[model samples]
Target: MLLPTTLILLASLVQAATLTLKNSRFNITSKDATELRAEPLSVTEKLSSPLKLDRTDILRLTFQVVEKDNGNNVQPHQAFLRFYDETTDEEGIQPVRVSNTGKGKFELNMAKPPTSLPPTGSAPLRVSLLIGSFVHSPLKVELFDLHVPASHPPAQHTEEASYHPLPPLGHTFRPEQKLPPRIISASFTGLALAPWLVPLVLWGKVAPSTPRLFSPHILPFVTTLALFEGLLFWYWIDLRLGQVLLYGGILALPTVFAGKHALASIGERRLGLARK
Candidate 1:
């Protein structure tokens, strides 16, 4: 009957409508991450009514950073959004860098698989400010102007296309070379020693008051360096150059140094070692 057809049409229209979020200003606080000594601000939007959004839909977001501090103007500003993914355990992130004109707008084409909504759908999405040294300014994110359309091009097939690595040769075969046992052995040896050697270098060079084995800074530095190296090795081994990782590694070294300082400061505070 005509009733069934009308119902289907209504459903389709409901599925295709765009979603706009309530705008609000988020506070950057040191209470959450006192050790980091950096202001990381986040704003999360939990839909009042769950909308049906396909994985391929694009999101056009318009927002502004209304800095509360007076006369502390920085020209260029960079931010990142940590979008919550329903499919994976890890959240997906995209960079939002723009000239500090107080207001900015950008579009995220959900072409990447990681940014896609899960088969079950996504309920909430988060957009956060990741700039480390923003001088702890309150950010006003205006999502009232968000424009999301349900119709997007279907995601590309994920199956990898096959290609020959070598050119065709006339009846000539080259045996695949395997890594020598000695080199493999050396690599394994270095993997174990390298992490420890970093701490040893820090101990000898920095020469902290505490013993190297028991130093609070040693554990944190070693752990952080190991994670950094692991990520670098993983990316390079997969034939991928991670520029973000490279920059992060450079930034993280100073952060690790800062961690040592934080630890010392905390200890001094606890022991009432404030200077007169």
Candidate 2:
């Protein structure tokens, strides 16, 4: 048990080691492969002068990770180059590809810059290196400042104007139709109702006898027919077609049975008179 405890303590100490960089360097070149600027980078200090680049320039950086205690090469789980613009507060992070031997390389071609590069203006961007690992302490080193040409404004979409809110709608309606004069309306109404008087006058003149109208056999049929007429009148006045149809259907069953019975009774009475 004592030996196991000692080994665990040794392992923890090894895992807590700090990381550093070695042989770090960067260079800028023109489109024709002419070396424009070259410098060795220091892990503890920043460059005194900011780097400048043109539209067709290329920048290349190389470095190696190592343990601070023994100066032995070591690979970190994550390595990134960060570019930040102080004036705009915009930052971009670009990953650095490192090999198993801790050698890392990064390249930026201004002709076709990566999307991770932040938008630039007159102000220079602060450059920094970041290294992180689960087994080792994290490391961050300020590298230098960079200046590039100002970026052009992004192009607008052809239909971008449609995205804005539309103006409030203004509706126009014609005035309500004017009604005809009251006297003319009254005259037309009277004319329409004048024909109904003919039947009433004929009814009064004939005074036809209807002794069986109130009889139980005939009363139901007559009442059902009168109700049917009343239902239609109600429909014209206020009730909808659906209401009229419903009431008429409910009244129809009785109407049919009553009509059948009344007809049958009249036939019997006629037969008796004929036999006598």
Candidate 3:
């Protein structure tokens, strides 16, 4: 009972550890000689204390953009967050593009921190918002919140720090829940083949002959299998839409031919038996 209880408590702590931004507000826009600009607004609390980060933590950032006017006259504006080293005055990490997430909201994630840095006593990082373009009407943009998970304690110094590739952006793993190979295979099979079921059944009923549930139409079967293999290869190689469609069309031709021939063969067999 003690072991199980301890495990449950550990899991709860893992889920609850997250650091969030406390202060965020939009300031005024300015113009210098040629074009207008919006100064980067400070989002986090003052730099008196160091922000803690865990090795396996993901940085979650949220932004809100409210267009002052709804009319088409207002030109589009782009916003981005730049992370900089306060001491060195350089880019601390890769800049994240702010994307509109409907209903006057935008969000960005630092899925993986570009590189690990040496430990610092004071807040060593600062973030700023950059707006690209002149705005006649005010576009109210502000960083809503920022959150990072609290996990493995900060390392003592630069020599011992190590960072691994981050897991898929928003996924968390649990120890007790078991996922086996057979279950995974079944899931993948269901996902891949389920979409064709209704259409395949309808095709079988409307065809000239009773369709063969499993007939050895050698050529068509082999062709369809090869085409499917090619499709999978092309998809994994490039993961592009054009190539997927090209291979999908090629795969579809062989599949249709196989189905039609297989059904015809089954129909012929049934008719022969009926005459006998």
Candidate 4:
């Protein structure tokens, strides 16, 4: 009577509740701990699972089920998998309807479908497992903190067709390696002083309000350009921007250049070296 209804209600509630914030009752370890718990948003509450894209790479997801069963013994069954992203919905996330074959410890030949970087991070190309409208586990496949060279499909050429341009090899910088607050504040202090220093060093005539010569907005824009973009270009050469001193030096280049030009323009006028 009420018992059957109660079980169904309980199961549905459990299914809807989010899971990632909770303790992972089951342990999911891999040969390489490159990707840990990353799941699709829809089923993120059910399971924090990993996915296997290449036919050879293995997917190992472990979970804990309630011991008591209402009707069927809780066993792994054939569930539909949808290769989808944020815009994709429950209906749209359906798999390409190809065969998994599920042979040899569940070997899969699925390709990691295209995905956009997350709003806050680059952890994309996620994976999820659906179980009767109850998508259990979801996993986010991340190669590593260090960017690895990704392989692309071979180009098709018939001698007449134009060759397609290669994708950008932009690497992600880990946020964990950001400068500490004290260091960041000190760095800003230096960048703030750049404009005035340029005038002083070149012409030896400091502006009356040299400290506050430029508008406030200019400082942050110059500093950000100096720090992030400069560092990126510096690292594109494959230099280890991870180290503190080297990274700082690389980022400082743009700021220095800006200040230098500012000096030559204004400083020369003050020194009577050139026209204002």
Candidate 5:
């Protein structure tokens, strides 16, 4: 058992080997297929001078991942090229494609710049390569500083001004709603109340008899109707619609019974008069 365990540990240690790059180089070409610069990349050392790119230039980088112990080619799980703008604290990550045999290649065409390229300014961008694998140790290489032309300003939205804070809401409410003069108000009130005087004048002139006006059954119905009117007036003044509805519902039962009793009593009196 001890021997098997020792062998298994040794195998794991060998499987978790460190990764390195080989045959790494970068080349820059102009739009007319003219070679501007070509140099081999050293994994241990960064380039002394920054690489400059024009608007119509193409840059290509090629490398191969290998084991540090036996120099065997390896395809890592993840590989990426990173462009970072230190001054702006902005970074862009671009994936690097690697073949099964571990040959990785990346191309950047300046004529049609990729979205993965960070927004460039006057300062140069720091370029680096990253490799990660589950069975092997990770590797990071500082490649070179890249100088790209300043990018065009981002487009502004048409309604961008709406996003800004509005000028401190100058509210012009209906100027404190001044009441009308007391004389004018009183005149309107008198005009509104003028119709009530007609019934009083008619009553005085006709003097009609109402023998059952104060009868117990009739009185209850009349009082309930008056209460309904009062409820409506109270709603207009201070009470809410919910309160008025609740009170009216409670008064409805008594009103219904009183109205039925008064109607039955009148029917009985008419039948008795017919019999007479």
Candidate 6:
């Protein structure tokens, strides 16, 4: 009889230990349907309740919960906090017993700090609240705790350090639609066929003094016409609009180059003046 009793007690202890070891939880069922609030207001990380701490530091937290539907129904609840630095995870809290406060008010304190210095950092220290009576197993109970300062005992190197990577910025992304490759292939083909089409297609040239990229008058007109026609064609054309396309596309690259050079030249002039 004594040996069987010992085995049963050992099994119960093991089950309790397993429950305490669990760090993540999300159930927030309330016994009393009242307004309950968790402090620090971040809703960041969570863990399950009835959690045991290998070690715990002193923690302090306060709650100010009023009725969500009416101002007159102001009822305060109490909770206990328990943290084991030996068990560290600050993602969130899980409630074993939510809304365990029996009366309209209550308070609680844990036995020790939940963690060592390196584990507790500056996070809201977790606490488990055992509101109302410890007896009857309190079927009507409310529980919640605030982030108190976890007293992490000091040691070597830096305590409470964490790492996370920052997301990159800007649109340097390219789709693998073969658009660029096709465009490049077409460009090379155009260049290869340029000598053959020069006299046959673009049979004229502006004066020698006129810059090729910014040929005083015609380049701007040609560039603008090319843009207008290209846009129109892209929007509505079912087949290639050769005359309008050549008119516009030829000037597109040159117009852009001229504009860039203009900006560069102006910047250089301003920089020179500033230096002087």
- Per-residue lDDT, model 6, residue 52, is 23
> Taking the candidates one at a time, how many backbone clashes does each contain?
0, 0, 0, 5, 0, 36
Error of 1 at 252 (Å): 78
lDDT tens digits by residue: candidate 2, 1-276? 999999989879868888889999999999999999999999999998999989999999999999999988888999999999999777889999999899999999999999888888899989999999888889999999999887764346599789999999998899999878999999999999999999999999998788888899889989888988988888899998888888989999999999999989988987998999
Off by over 4 Å in 1: 1-47, 50-52, 69-77, 111-131, 137-276
lDDT, candidate 1, 1-276, per-residue tens = 999999888766544432211232322122232221112222443323322223454444444443333323333345555554343343446666545653444455445433433222223443344432233433323122111233343344465334436566678678988777998889998898889988788889898665453456456665666667776677677735667567676769866785677577667765885563
lDDT of 3 by residue, 154-192 (tens): 445465345645566785667686666898989998999
For all predicted structures, in order, the TM-scores are 0.28, 0.59, 0.26, 0.21, 0.62, 0.17
Candidate lDDT scores, in order, read: 0.47, 0.91, 0.47, 0.41, 0.91, 0.41
- For model 3, the local distance difference test gives 0.47
lDDT of 6 by residue, 124-179 (tens): 44444333222112222123333444545444445334344557676877866654
Give candidate 3 misplaced runs (Cα > 4 Å): 1-50, 68-76, 92-95, 99-111, 115-123, 136-276
Which prediction has more favorable TM-score, 3 or 4? 3
In terms of TM-score, how similar is model 1 to the real structure? 0.28
TM-score of 5: 0.62
Best-matching candidate per TM-score: 5
Clashes of 5: 0
Q: Candidate 5: give the clashing pairs.
A: none
For candidate 3, the per-residue lDDT at 213 reads 40
Candidate 3, pairs of clashing residues: none
Model 6 segments more than 4 A misplaced:
1-79, 83-119, 122-124, 132-135, 139-276
Tell me model 1's lDDT, rounded to 2 decimals. Answer: 0.47
lDDT of 5 by residue, 1-276 (tens): 999999989879866789999999999999999999999998989999999999999999999999999999999999999999999777899999999899999999999988998878898999999999988888999999999999865356699899999889687768687789999999999999999999899989998677887998678878888888988898999998899889989988988888788878878987999999
User: Between candidates 1 and 3, which one is better according to TM-score?
Assistant: 1
Clashes of 4: 5
The deviation in Å at residue 71 for candidate 6 is 18
TM-score of model 6 relative to the true fold?
0.17
> What's the distance in Å from true for residue 93, model 2?
4.8
